[model samples]
Target: MLCTDCLALRDQVAIYENELDMLHEEHQTQQLTDIQQLKGVKNPRRSGTGQLGSLRADRHVFISDSGAKGTIESLVEPSDGVATVTVEFPTPDVTPTILGIKEYYCQLEESLQFEFKATSAVSLGDHKVAELAKGPKVAVTDASKVTDVGELKNLIAELQRELADLEKCGEELEVEIEERKEVYLEEIAELQVRRPCGDSQSPPAIGWTCVCSCVTLCCVEELENAQADLDTQMKEQCADYDELLSEKMALDIEIAAYRDLVELEEDRLCYL
Candidate 1:
């Protein structure tokens, strides 16, 4: 019933629609591929440094330049395959516990103690390093030779300020930990008073037991979270400290070079 020109135009329109659908499908597929590629780039499984990937949990991972094996305690993977791995080695003073405690309260206490020790050690080490570096202040014999002596002084002053800030942060962290410990102790004592035993069918008593368990779990998790935060803080502080040390060494070298230049200038002026 349709004219030849009309039928031909209808077929052409259908072909164009099919082509568009195919193009759309291809576009969607390409978009998906791009998304996957971006994710892979963000969280690379294999190290760009040519480190081999392993699926075995017990396999030793090398973390240092010397290729020393460290037992991977845990791996936190916030993004797909990429992880922040915590590697630990067996030491005489501190050994990782292979077996976990069944009791919730005991586990919480143990976690708290472990975090406390780690935080203490890092703080103490930082303090000692800071003290050692502070001594024998950079004495510029010919301060006039260094044109940017004021800048160098400012840099050193900034380092001192950073150290003070770090000390303050550590004190704050300790105070927070102490406060948390007190709160935990109070909760534990309250739980002890309300400790339910013997098969009680009462709904209220059962609910109370659940609450105690939840509280215990929350305490344990909170301590773990605090430990993680402390670890992050320690890394940041260490980086800052290293930067300060590097700057100090560079400044010392620059000062020495300038002093030599000044001496050369003096000799030339005397000759003239």
Candidate 2:
């Protein structure tokens, strides 16, 4: 008793439902892959060759606050996160200066209490000792005086603004994804309701079944094309979302580093 157009609409709905299920499965697999990739990535800040990695014994460096040239005697990391660095000056009468490193690095100009400039050689050894004894000491730049507090504040503020912007973009993308899903669902529902058989109550005319079959075939082809386009778009959106998340993670690390630097600077100023 079913008309040709009604049967075609039923077939279209089944095909669409199957494609929707496949798309959902594909999206879940893609999400799992993205998560695995994220886990495999290593944070660059904690790497061996990072800024803090250069701290070692016998390295020639000059204190930024005090223009005192010295050699690192030892670097120790205790149970506490803060590290301790012992620097030995050439004068036998002068005692070694013990510095606390709260995630501190020598080369950064932002360092308030201490800044270390590492020489290429591990130990200048006796040559540096002899040179120090000769009394024409190596010139040490007062990096603390050159550091601009205002500039650091501005940099931190800029980084915070960028982080906020990225967060907003991520939220927008999520909303967009939801909106696209709703739109696709609405379109599918509309297609079902607009079927020729659903609108017309009268009996079929001569050769009407043939015309309905041709129309149904065309609709099915269009539906397949639309599904393909939707799948491609969803994949692209997911990729973009993943990329944004990675960038957000990097920004979070960078923001933490800058905050640490600011805190260290403030601590130094409090003691002064």
Candidate 3:
């Protein structure tokens, strides 16, 4: 027969175990949802795979601004919702150039001209990062992929480096976008203020109003289109960031489990 204190401790332990089980179930469900999202079910922006959907290494691209032709060396996905493409030109004298993903269009015969360009958008916040850290473990790297613990550690280190780069890129892009937006906004305001008022003596005020209205309509349409494109790009970047974060979290969990297994094996050996 257990004492009252002993019975109380047992009850507490049972309750704790039940709570843990519920948490585990919730985690599994979240993982399923995340996997489905990564598969592009929830994100219509994700098309194809491998870095911004078809912007993979070795793809030929043309820099529209400079008219320089080159093969894609790599695509750096931005944290601030922009994509940067590194291109290697055939001319040895010409150093490999990095351009905004929008600056270049894919030259693939099957691929349509990609109109999407990276713009300034929301920055991934610390709170969001913390929330993602609690998400279910995703199997980013298979256990069989690494033959030894050393190899696994190396892979994790590489991933950490990539994650750091992405975070830095996001910060820089955010600042740049804000500055560009401000400058453009100022210019637009100045243009509006400087517009010549229709002279009552020459052109009728009504005719001037009509001309101004047409110009305003065109400008409004252009701005609307630009804003829509920016929103789409932002969504795409957020999805990419989430997918990468999930992968990193999964790898971290895998390493932790591996360590636990090793420790358990060591304890069994000691008892033997």
Candidate 4:
């Protein structure tokens, strides 16, 4: 239906359109590549000196993605809009621990406190028991000539009063310790607000030095007074505890001796 020249022109036109379509697709591909490269690029804002502060081009930037590890060799943007991303092929395979470092430290601190309290209590109890043993032996020797039930009853009542006083002293010391911790924590919180991230010269920072120091000193003085009070109370209570223990040992000996005398008297009557 067509001549040879016409058919040849049609063939040339079809080839040209195919080549243009191919060029358009190649251009689209190049654009997409450029876009992807720009996605990861970042511009470091210049500081007052026209130089980037705290932005080191050679600093190693750690990157982990999809089990792949990499280091950013340089963050400088190039003329052709491509970033030099240096990446190592394989990453170290370290198993994760059940507890993080912060949690582990917290748990460790708690355990140490528990251990300290438990050890101190046990040692004090053992020492007191040893002292009581010595007291009872001495009391037995002294009780050979004493035999008064009324006197023993009075000694028992006095020991109970001393125990109650010691318990009250211990309770007061515990309350003071709690209060000291609270005041210290409050001071720490105030310090944190005054200087966040350890930057003392931060903008808009209020001058809190005078007031904070006064408050802190007051708290420290209170803590010191409480500690002195606790020391005095402990000394007084320990002395009282020792004296009461000795008296209790003597009372117990007197009671036992009296019981033996009564039994002996009863046996003599039965013989009659």
TM-scores vs. true structure, each candidate:
0.36, 0.26, 0.29, 0.29
Residue 101 of model 1: what lDDT? 13
**Superior by lDDT: candidate 2 or candidate 4:** 4
Compared with the true structure, the alpha-carbon lDDT of candidate 3 equals 0.43
lDDT of each candidate versus the true structure? 0.48, 0.41, 0.43, 0.47
lDDT of 4 by residue, 1-272 (tens): 11232344345445644654565466556645654564556566576679743322333545455443433344344434354444322332121211232243344346545644664586443323122211121121232133465655565565556556555665665676678668767776777576744466653344465566667678667656655554554564555446445545645643564465456435433422
Rank by lDDT, highest first: 1, 4, 3, 2
**Which wins on lDDT, candidate 1 or candidate 2?**
1
Better of 2 and 4 by TM-score: 4
User: Predicted candidate 3: what Cα RMSD to the true structure?
Assistant: 36.2
Worst 10 residues of 4 by lDDT: 132-141
Off by over 4 Å in 2: 1-210
lDDT of 3 by residue, 91-125 (tens): 11111221211122112111211211121244544
